[model samples]
Target: MSCSECGSPTIDFSLPERYRASLSTDAAVANCCTRCLTVEPVTDADTDASTPEFGRISDAVPTDQEQAIPLLLALELADSLATNRDAIESLLRDVERAGADPLLAIDRLARDPDLEPRVDLERRSHQIEQLLYYSNN
Candidate 1:
């Protein structure tokens, strides 16, 4: 089924029996939109519970792989830079001079459109926020 938020195709997954009982309705499955990440419970009649759908979205909708290109590029760059101890030290010094936390600097780099133009930083802002929260904890 399509997502009500972004109209992107949704991936369906079966809810465990324990969790199913908590819901008022007898929905054994839930659909999560791959793009917007919106999740909603779906009954068996709304979808085929036997086989969960995957990779059946329209061509116009960007696939997860396509959306990950910028992240991949950023990760590759970070990995390559990690091999250079001097570069890492220099980056640390720069961040220190700017009076910014190293982790926040990394988050800013990830969200910088000029650095990774293809990345939808706005859409992934929550992920960045979570990363910061977890790292602090």
Candidate 2:
């Protein structure tokens, strides 16, 4: 079956033994495409009887720098929008799916001396939180 997130047909249900225990069913294999699995781990709750083996993506924890980097970049980009409320809203959802700590990432971004204008980091961070919360709800 195709992956739920990216719809790629290359599904490898028999993931390495490491990822197997985390998953329950052969049918409910984490979507084959590494990109989908990499984005977030699939949890039991995300699976069910009817849907294709690939189910909802969970806020799987980021294990290392490679995993964390994309989330960090997504959080940073979320802060600066050039209009397009729709895109902003979409990006907010993507950031939420990323499952990174918005507050921490925003604070770090704000504190960066490299950032040209470092004004109102806290407020911007709060805005990001609000977007995440509101989007999720």
| Candidate 1 weakest ten by summed lDDT | 68-77
Highest TM-score model number? 1
For model 1, the superposed segments whose C-alpha errors exceed 4 Å read: 21-25, 44-46, 53-137
lDDT of 2 by residue, 66-133 (tens): 33334332332443643333444444444456564545655654565433221355566666566656
TM-score per candidate: 0.35, 0.33
True lDDT of residue 23, candidate 2: 32
Candidate 1 lands at a TM-score of 0.35
What's the lDDT for candidate 1?
0.43
- Per-residue lDDT tens digits of candidate 1, residues 36-122? 444467875666544544233222222332232222222222333325333334434433454544444345544543332123444
Per-residue error for 108 in candidate 2, Å, reads: 1.2
Model 1, position 2, has a per-residue lDDT of: 88
Instruction: Give the residue spans of candidate 2 off by over 4 A.
Output: 1-82, 117-121, 135-137
